[model samples]
Target: MPSIRCCSSFALAAALAAPGLAAACSTCGCSLNSDWSSQGYATSLGWHLSLREDYFNQSQLRSGADSVSRSSFAYPADEEVQRKTINRNTLLGADYSFSRYWGLSLQLPYMDRHHQTIAEGDTGVSTSDARGIGDLRVLARYQGFSDDAGIGLQFGLKLPTGRFKQDFVSGPQAGELLDRGLQLGTGTTDALLGVYKFGYLTDSIGYFGQAMAQIALDAREHFRPGNSLNLNLGLRYLDAGRFTPQIQLNLHGEQRESGAQADRPNSGAVLAYLSPGIGVRITRRLDAFAFVQLPVYQHVNGLQLEPRRLWSLGLQYRL
Candidate 1:
């Protein structure tokens, strides 16, 4: 028989392993195919504030049915399922130029997420909202090589701070939602390594790209934070002397695996979108911009998350 402390540890590990099971066990995991930061270097203060609105129409699942399989307390019959989510985020930080060989960067972000599900013919709907500061990241960039044409190198980091608890809806999956949203930290540390490069195609045109992979340490049991990979590609139109107006597109994806021997699921998720954005130079020390993200494709564990589409408007200032 296991000791009391050992039993408690086992129980805790099982509980922690549940969330990833949903992603890992089914086709839904296919959606977790890439990392989240595939946008290259196109944000504002070098700071950026983005407000996004997302709408999703989920597939209907069967509820309680009547005798003879007639019509009873079924879910909304309408095929149109709707959910609205709002996210407001601010990234404040800067990149330092430490000669042509080394550099450093720091960033902190504040996030607020609100979700609502609306069903046809139903007067009462369900809602969940959370607001708080999210994780903080510190990074160092090395300028391994550069010419008048472009610069390239590797980067790495530390992520601290976790989100806080917030209200959740009541339902069968309420616990899952609450756990995903309010569990604060993953109770683990993450390390990432990435390569970035930027250069000009011409005096008036520029391009950038980056790739990164991360591994988790001290992860919760059954919830092995799988290795993640991200890629970014973008093009910009530079002003001869002033700030430039940039119209660019970004792509991102991620994958997560369950811990070994854990009865949990393992899976992947991928999100790919195109964003048209614009940036303006306000002064020698300031710039601002806005963009919209439209999901061209998204697959979660082999199932579709409805129509994966979102709109984002943002602004940034640099000093």
Candidate 2:
């Protein structure tokens, strides 16, 4: 058996490192691995590494003109404008376990953003592309309670380490509109709380679930800081003492508080997604998995940005 002191020490380390791993969640977003494992415990010192990529295409804007005619003069009364944008995200990270109940993880990410506008005469303006590293995150998980009862608690923190500049822009003209719209970091701290549970349905099949929430501490002008909640359910099949196939579904929502900035309005947003994932075990000491995130509903600040279609792929190695 591992010494109690050793386990406690590892737990402390994981808790302290939680902030770094939490930052990674900003780009990758929260995942289903609330405690870093479905079992809530590690058999030995272990490491997990993963990579992910994401792409986004925004909707096009439309405009029309209004005209008024009088006996003396005729003039256009109104004009319209629209914009389009694209974004990409790349994430990389790794984690280490000191014992079955304790572990630490960290992640870093890079982001690219592009914007453009088209006018009525087939004329267009292309904004420069902006690329740079995003925020960083650290995470820690401890199986506070485990065994026949099948329950545990995991805590996490997020730190702001990414670059933040008010004047930085993709085009020659820089302003708050662009800075706030294309923010790379929230410039604030965030905290997470989660609960985990698992059970067996049969000798070869098992089930796991988790509930998580996050709170952000800083608020940007016209942007209200907010909280998010996530719930996950998974089914796992064990075989040959080597490979396990797993499938999972997740539901999530977020609420934002109103802000004071007059130029920007504060509004709430909600999102729901259904994802299917699979895990493969290469050996007793190594495992990998991949999944796609597809949105079912999304409302941003009372505006609908796009149709519910997005996907993410990731691979993990355990050592």
Candidate 3:
């Protein structure tokens, strides 16, 4: 028979794990994928704030890792130049739950980017750097499902708050404009819809699944980004002392960008990642989490730079 303290600890673990923990995704583009972050944690009326950072460095032009079979254009053997990019992001997000049934979340991010394009014949590299605030996202959530399980719907808007037309200031392309896709923001308003579900597989383990769709409501500067969808499925262990271990499978797909300024050939892809993470409960109202997403499968429409791996780290506090 289990002791009373052990039983109580189990109950506490279950109670804490029943609600979704809050954490941001690393690959939602400029939009906020906050649906999974609010689950299992916002069961009551409370305010939550989180600070997260993620990094990605893309130096290789891959058509799925060294194979250019799917690319529409092939590089000549003499062509020695391609593109490389390094992106860093810092995000601050806040959430307020009016009750167990209603909540709102807002996120703002600062983006730092460095892009380099090598010349075809020369070994010279041209570099352009841009740093500024990115887009903003606001989401309203409604959780009208049974208390024992979690199911919810989210509707939101993405505001264009960053710079879309960034010019190369000190490179070979100086005075020339960068690709619209490489800009800090889309300069278009977007609509977001999402669904999430959370439940227990057993007494000591839990699972969550979420899907989100983002579409541009309007175009800007004759450029319109493509529609995107993100799906995540994860499992977590509840009774692991102060450390919760989790694994997630994430699938992200996008339609190609369209417009006169769009680079359709290098715009869209469907990628699958295996993300493993750990959650630490620092206190009753504070928590920390980190995740690393590794690409298991990738299919790009054209030649593009894709990161070998991505990582996210964050801290959350409830008030």
TM-scores, all candidates, are 0.64, 0.69, 0.84
Write down the lDDT of every candidate, Cα atoms only.
0.39, 0.48, 0.64
Q: Write the per-residue lDDT of candidate 2 for residues 1-319, one digit (tens) a residue.
A: 3222211111100111111111001112333342344353343577766576656564422111111122222222121122445667677867787776776767676877665432223333325355787667666666647544356566666666654453424332434243333446555577767777766677676677777677776654444345666677776665434444556666655554434421122223444556665555555444455556576555444222232344555555555
- Highest-scoring model, TM-score: 3
Ranked candidates, highest TM-score first: 3, 2, 1
lDDT of 3: 0.64
**C-alpha lDDT (0 to 100) for residue 68 of candidate 1:** 18
Tell me how far candidate 1 lies from the true structure as C-alpha RMSD in angstroms: 13.8
lDDT of 2 at 236: 64
Which regions of candidate 3 are displaced past 4 Å?
Answer: 1-38, 64-81, 119-123
Clashes of each: 28, 11, 6
RMSD per candidate (Å) reads 13.8, 8.8, 6.7
Best by lDDT: 3
lDDT minimum window of 10 residues, candidate 1: 9-18
Model 2 TM-score, all chains together: 0.69
Q: State the lDDT at 139 in candidate 3.
A: 81
Better of 1 and 2 by lDDT: 2
Q: Which ten residues in a row have the lowest lDDT in candidate 3?
A: 14-23
